[model samples]
Target chain A: MTDPLPTGATIGILGGGQLGRMLSVAAARLGLRTHIYEPGANPPAADVAHAVTTADYTDTDALRAFAQSVDLVTYEFENIPTAALDTVEAIVPIHPNRRALGTSQDRLTEKTFLQELGLTVAPFADVTDAAALEAAIAQIGTPAILKTRRFGYDGKGQARLTSPDDAASALDSLAGAPAVLEGFVSFTAEISVIAARNPQGDIACYDPGENVHRDGILHTTTVPANIPARLRTDAVLLAARILNALDYVGVMGVELFVTPQGLIVNEIAPRVHNSGHWTQNGCTVDQFEQHIRAIAGWPLGDGSRHTDITMENLIGDDMDRVPDLAKDPKCALHLYGKADTKPGRKMGHVNRVTG
Target chain B: MTDPLPTGATIGILGGGQLGRMLSVAAARLGLRTHIYEPGANPPAADVAHAVTTADYTDTDALRAFAQSVDLVTYEFENIPTAALDTVEAIVPIHPNRRALGTSQDRLTEKTFLQELGLTVAPFADVTDAAALEAAIAQIGTPAILKTRRFGYDGKGQARLTSPDDAASALDSLAGAPAVLEGFVSFTAEISVIAARNPQGDIACYDPGENVHRDGILHTTTVPANIPARLRTDAVLLAARILNALDYVGVMGVELFVTPQGLIVNEIAPRVHNSGHWTQNGCTVDQFEQHIRAIAGWPLGDGSRHTDITMENLIGDDMDRVPDLAKDPKCALHLYGKADTKPGRKMGHVNRVTG
Candidate 1:
């Protein structure tokens, strides 16, 4: 096993968003510094990180320099380009590894990986062309969702077919990009387990949180999710299996669908997820710090929930209610330092201790 | 009343130590930026702050430039030279106000202010010379402590008088500097109330934490301090009175001696106190965030504690235990990014939730 990182070591992060901002703060608490590699100017994480390099991922020179500067590399977003990873990996180690990122990046690959692990996933078929999509639609039946095989997030690059009549238009909307046809499952509710694995293979998972969505974006996540004790245990076990199978050394968010037969795998996020934000107030070690600890080769922190919490995201104009939330005794506000609040933009979040 | 600072306003901190580092992280969570002004070349707070100005306090041009760049100014250390403050106050507002600093800067002034407000304080006398020290010792009696009137911290600049014979040596040790002779009180325990007041006159106080000191330095602070309910109430009220008396607009740490008669004010810190560190895990709004909120003119957060916690300071070699502590489920370690660890230096702290 790798030795833990010494204090003051710099950790390189790939994306510069709210997750990176929060991760930077957590890393600083542990006496670790962060160097952010982002293409955009004035990224939120830059405000708190030790250093920031504003260069595109394709810049191998910049990537190599950034990787060489830090002791190890990790990323906030999972969609890093493969070539960029190869360049960074040559100079420094990246946690959650390239395999984890690759599997989660593509819908078809993620489903196949889960099925291979004997975990129940949505019935899915890969579509390389119009003919392939048509054949997959016939096999999967109507009311299936056609999603771009790669790079789809927050409801983007997805087309829903209500019946067989809509399959042709849905396939046409993909613009010839690779796609996946997934048959819908009737889920009672959606829940996620925020789990972490250290370099030593130790695992810890926080209590499942029931997630609610609005306009295809996460709205809120309430811990002590209304699921049976058996299901909760199974959810945690299944998440641990995935982490161990991937040889993951960081936090991962595993979304699951609760159905009559059993829990079905929805998807996985290779970094700290929005659904786990409540851990910041409800647990001794939050998901951001957990991820940092894992990537830095430190022991995984206890992820037990001590307080029942409800986490609500403040998207776009929702920031207007901040003044009132700030005065709330039970609310803990976490605002990302994003200047402009455009529609659908995640501006901040508040975690309220309910019990 | 001054309007609350809008999001994204820059807050200038005068000192760049651990207190400033934690404060900077808290401010960022609220979408506020921090600019650190430190004379030292690689201050710890610089790692997480939005900007840092490395210039001596005596440099009027640098001080002026730093003040003008931020919306408001605050300091982590109380001993900032009055001249530097005068220079900065000309350009930006400084919270906790000038009076709070002036009063707390001198032991004589602080004791006098508490007495004038009808608050109980240790019997004290200003000692200007050897003869005055002898006279004060005679009046205050043996078992007294002679401390410098200004610029003393962490038990430095203090001499203990075990009996009348020790007075001469104690007085001689002062080297003719202004001093205060304080009569010792027989106290069962020491506790501190972390309190805050906003510009709009809103006040909130966290439950007092019982403190233990070793070698005249804080060792641990356990919340839900083993004190009677009535005394806890009195402690909070007394702390609130001190805030009101100062018209304070920031967090203040009020140390008190739990005596048979009543609580005696030991001293007050104009900034966040080390004793309040347990709030990082036990309270919804920790002292650092409360300080930022008050200084920014935001409504004070609920200072109520939800979980019982014990905070232990990692002084010098105590950092060796961090690896083990990191693996503990209940421990939340906070390490200051100071590269070197000298004896008696506070390197970090850990907050453990007991219940």
Candidate 2:
């Protein structure tokens, strides 16, 4: 028989942003080692990881060596190239699987897959070129968004269409890239359900967090998200259905629009999500550790919330206010030590637990 | 003006155990780096620290290089040899100062210092030999204790004298080392006050925790300790007094015996303590992070506890119960990745919080 994995086995991560940074911290806490693999230059997750590899993602030789050394592979972001994914998966298990990656990487397929499950999704159509863009706009109507099917996050590579006349210019904005057009849903608020699926087919989901956004960057997420109990159950059920369909084996973030009629699927992220940051101070176990446990085949931790929590993101210059905010006995401030305070960068967050 | 130290400055730590391991995790959270300087081989702290210097504490070359490279020095244990301490302090700023170290290193001096501060301490006298022990026991009376002057923890260097007949044997058991005789104070319970003081003279203290010990090793600490409000105030004030007298900087643990009359000071430790581990899951700021902020000259964090907490130490064979303990919704299990779980080793701890 192959060697049984040890409890302190090393886990290799392929992206080194805030997600990876938090993941590395969680891995260390659980008596496991983490090796971060990031492409070139930025400090990213190296500050806290046990080891780091700063080679290009496309370097086949380095990729092979990395896969050979680690017992398992997981990534923070889903934009990993297909070739790099194959190289690593050949030697070790990659959680979320190739099928989930292919579906989430392309918007057209993700929406179609959700529709097949009889789950609610915004009306959408694939747009291959300018001619197709106009036809899709006619079918989905005005007041919509046109987003590139792959490599988009935090509102990047997407443009809103308020009028039919702007369809041609919007297509050019994406530079003739494969895109999807979807009619906008007039929802009252946005909420996210963070769920984790273990390799043993057990699933656990945290309470949905009602989120607020500013300039497409997350501003705050508060638990007991001002939604009806029915809505909350539906959100969790929808997430479970998606994870089961994809055979997901880690934490997946499902964003939903709470409309007057019901909840509609926005998209799915096959990794940890920012909306669950409140768990750092509010729950028995935060999402990061839960993800690591699920991927490692360890038993899942309790995801129960101990108190009502409010989490606010520290964007850009807001980090300077840390000293003033830390004095409040109710707030737990966490600042990501990014070297620069450029505009729109997520510096850190603060969690306030109300008894 | 002297240049301000950068955020990622190296901090040299003198011991490499669970305390140092926890401190290293805290330092990483602040974007700072830690280099542990320990005399033993394969220390637990080496698993997570940025660097480790494994050599005899008396190795001048190793100590010199460690001191030169680090910006400031702190220690996990109070028993560093005087010569070794002098070499390191000559190069970098050692926080909690040498005065604190000298007082804490010996029982006789520590008691004398407490008595001078008008704090209640068990009556004690110096014992140089068996004859002095007999005379000291006559003054302090039976049911007293005889202990070595330095390098004792977990009941390792002390013997209890239940009767006059036990005094001679107890003194002989210590191998004629320098010792102190102490009278036993009638105590109802044991408690600990954890506090931090910065170079700027700012002090923050957490509420006292009621502790239970078995075989002289801490077994559990419960927050919102069953003590009167006035007792907590006195504990805090006593800690602050010791800190100001020593001109201390960094976290300090002041252990006390809660008598029906009032709280009596027993001993003080100049480092993060096991009793305060509940803060990891129950408070806005943990004791480990508070220690780092104090040493880094950063503003202190909030020290409020929202939920009632219970922290249990997982000693030696207790590690085998992790699988069952991890499944508890209220338990936040933390296991240090030590390779061997020999008897008396601090394998890990678990923090359970309840509203």
Candidate 3:
């Protein structure tokens, strides 16, 4: 087993989005440095990261050099190419392990994994072709969603099946890609539990936060989610069950649907989750730092929060409100320092705390 | 007056120590960037700053180039040379203006300024020479301190006199430097008020934090200082009075001694101070961000503390306890990432929060 990373050790991060930017800040707080490997120029994480290697993921030499420089590797996104992971894994260890990444990278695998653990998930079936799609639709029924098995995010690469007749259109929307047909489950709220586990099998979960989406993008996440305390406990326990099952070694975002019958697992992110951003202002140790602590082999911090918070994302043109928002005494801004604000782009987030 | 700096603006910081390192993070938090200029190699701020210029302060060309690249100039330390300030000021405005900086740069001047502002301060006299030192010693009386007029910090450049007979040795310890003799005031505690002001004259003051020194250096600072609530108001008022009087455009640390005869102003810092570190864990917006807001023309944040915090400096060997401290859930580590730990060198600090 690897020893806890010492102060000044550099951790290699595979993406340079806002998540990686925040993780860089958290690592800096712990006296550990980070080298961000991203293909884009002037990534949001570059301003705060210790080093940046702007090379495409397919560059084997660049990936090898990046891996050689850092003590270990962890990624902000789960869709990394398997060959790229193989290249870096040959040189250094990658936390949240490849198995966790593999499970989360594909919707079908994620649902099957949860079902195998005796957890409730929307009934889902795999479809590799037209015939297979029709058979899967027959089993999962109408009002289902056809989603790409891999490489999907932010409600992308998915189509809705309103009835048996819409099934053909939904399958065509997938464009011949491997797909998962998830049957509709009526739900009242979508809550996420940001959970973490260390290499030694210790698990910690932040309180569940209810999320509100706008235009298929997360708009806000409110802590102490509007759910019965019992379900809150259920959400946390379910998240822990998944973490332990995967033997996860970093923070994971477990998104669940709160239905009248029971909580149903929707999806999981094998990295610091957007819904957990409120912890930055509400908790003693935030999720980014928790992930850092876990992957560095340090003890997972007590995931206890001291304040109630509502975190709102400043997507695209929402940056205009920053002038007025900066004046809000209760707001703590965490802008991503993105140079431009394209539509649906996550520019920043603000956590408003209440006493 | 300059407009509030826009998103993506770059701030130039002088003295790339832990304070500057933190300011960089805060600027990044606000969607701004920072360029750190320091004479040292691989300064602690280098890892997080967007840019670093390693050049001597007297390297006027480099200084001018650094200033021209940034929207405004701010500093981590107050002992900046007048020539250096002039160079930067000629290109970009410097915050916490020269008046405030000049007043706090010298011990004699600082004490005189405080007294002139109708604030309580220790009885003091200036000594330009050894003969003058003896004369000043007689006026201030025995059991006083002989401190250099300029460039003293962390309890350096000072000698204490227990009695009149020790005057010659105390003066000798200063080696004929211009000095100040101040009669000691026995106080129940030492406290600091971290206050901020923007160009528009708006002011905000954090709650007073009691300080303890060990081996002449700040050891710990506890918020909601162990003092009467009335005195806490007095501390905040005194800090605001000073900031207003100077028209200070950034955060200033006001250290005061709580004596029976009200509070005596010990000294002032024209930049963020170590004693205010607890705000990182206790307040909605920390001192670093507040300072950045002030200098950038943004409104000052609400300096309300939601949690009580105790901030302790990790000096040299104190870093040995970091592993155990990291395991303590309430402790928020802020290591400076210094390469080597020398005796008395501040490697970092930890802020412990309480419910």
Candidate 4:
């Protein structure tokens, strides 16, 4: 039997954004310290973390020091470069491992890996060059999406190929980066399963929440998702398969498309995710705290929701409406202390609990 | 109209413990920075706050620097010395006001102030020395309690006078310190109103929660307290009266005894109280976050409980049962991250939501 990990361990997090900010808060509640590493001045997470390293990811010295200071390494986003991970891994354990990062960092690799694991994903083909783009588009057909295999998030670095005329411009839009063409699926809704896996192989998942998006930004997520019980079970099982296959430890968010046929994997986030924010108010264990427990090699927490809940994102200037939102007895508002409300930025969110 | 407070502003917290830890979390969610000013080593709040000052409260230079670094000052505890408040107040605004602190610090002053405000409190008298103790005991009678005038919490610095002989011991036990003799009020139950007062004089009270104490330490708090509508109204009015009297900003916990005659004030916490921990998983706005917002001069939050909730304290070695407690699907656990759990030490607490 493993000796229980004490509470004072430091958790090193890469990507000091809002996700890291929330994660640090969750870690603090469990008596854990968080050291945030980001390559910028005044990232959001810097405000709440115990220690912060404001240096480029390529700063090996800083990375090494951060790794040495922390007991374990986790991340808030999936775009962490291989070199950065390599440096940290040399000194400390990085949960979900480098393979999980490698697989999640690239769209093509993630799809192929999921397919190999017997999970149905959007039909896709790798596009290495102009010829590959044309061939993939021809097979995947019109109205498909052509996206760079790496470094894409919140709809950036991706383009829709609605027609043959849109194909070249779509490929050009990626600026010659390696891409993938994915055939569209007619789905009723999008859902996600936020689950955490411990090193001991224990898995716990918060109920899948149905999500709605506006302009590619998350709008709202409702738990006890309006789906058949079988479909919900399948979504959770698919997440378990992904975690087991990766030997994953830490929280993973598997976004899926709920179609008439069944559930299909859309993407995987090897960290606390936006869709899982509802868990902050809905579940017994929030995704951020769940990730901390997983990486610290502690026992998994209960991941059950005590009530049906809906989480609504307060994007950009929407935070200005907090005063009005406060009037509703059911709303729990969270506003990110971003310096400016730039267009399309996620400022905060509100959780409304329901019976 | 006042211009909106800028996001990313620094908030100075006066105590560094679990309350400040949760406050920091809430502030971060609103995109605000928190700097904790504490006079202790390795405080829990320091683990997550953006900045920390490990200096004595009366250290003027350190207090000046801390005051200058944040937009406003609020505390996690109410026993803060007047000199410390004066030091911070000279440089920055202190929430809940110095008048509130001065009145609440001394039992005699608090009782007199409440009576002057036309609020109901148990009969009490000052006990300065043996002569005064004898006089107070004669008037208040046996079975009264003698407590120090200042600096006491969690049932410390108090002695019960069951008889005239006990009065002398209680008075002598205080070592001739200034004290007060309070006549115990016969009541049915204990409840507290957790509420916030913004700079604009807006007061929002969460529904009262019934409290049960074990060994004078709060053990459980149940929301939507079992009380008549009129009693709940009276409880809220009494709390609002105190906040208005103090011209207080930030959240305050007002403890009361429900007597057959009516309600009587027991005590008041000028900071986030343990009884309000149920809001972490029950209410739309948690008391800590509400306190931060009020102190930061932001608008108060919606104070409502959408679900019935119960909070249970994790005392002493009871923390060893974290795993079992975390396994309960109905429970949400909050650990303080304290290094040791001695007898009567508040290690953590858990909130169980019952819809």
The best candidate in terms of lDDT: 1
For residues B1-355, write the lDDT of model 2, one tens digit per residue. 1232344577888998878888887786666678899888867676567678999988999999999989889999999999999999988888778998899999989999999999999889999987898889889997998889999888888999999899778988898889999899899989999999888888999999999998889999999898888988889999999898888889999999999888889899988889999888877779998898888777777577777999999999998887777667778878777778789888889997756
TM accuracy, model 2:
0.95
Interface RMSD, in order shown:
0.7, 2.1, 0.9, 2.1
* Cα misplacement distance, residue B69 of candidate 4 (Å): 1.9
Better of 2 and 4 by DockQ: 4
Candidate 2's C-alpha lDDT? Answer: 0.86
| Ten-residue stretch with the least lDDT total in model 2 chain B | B1-10
Report the TM-score of the second chain of model 2 against its true counterpart. Answer: 0.97
Quote the lDDT for B82 in model 4: 80
| Candidate 3 lDDT over residue span A1-355, tens digit each | 6789988999999999989999999999998899999999989899998899999989999999999999999999999999999999999999989999999999998999999999999999988888887898889888888999999999999999888898778878888889988899899999999999999888999999999999888999998899999999999999999999888899999999999998999999999999999999999889999999999999888899899999999999999999888899999999988988899999999999865
List candidate 3 segments past 4 Å from native: none
For model 3, state the Cα shift of residue B107 in Å: 1.4
Distance from true position, residue A281, model 1, in Å?
Answer: 0.7
Measured against the true structure, the TM-scores of the candidates, in listed sequence, are 0.99, 0.95, 0.99, 0.95
- Candidate with the larger DockQ of 1 and 3: 1
* Clashing residue pairs, backbone N/CA/C < 3 A, model 4: A335-B30, A336-B31, A337-B30, A337-B31
Off by over 4 Å in 2: A1-6, B1-9
Model 1 reaches what TM-score against the true structure? Answer: 0.99
Show how many residue pairs clash in every candidate, following the order shown.
Answer: 0, 0, 0, 4
Task: Provide the RMSD of all predictions against the true structure, rounded to 1 decimal.
Answer: 0.9, 2.4, 1.1, 2.1
Residue range B77-157, candidate 1, lDDT tens digits = 999999999999999999989999999999999999999999999999999987898789878997999999998898998
lDDT against true structure, model 1? 0.94
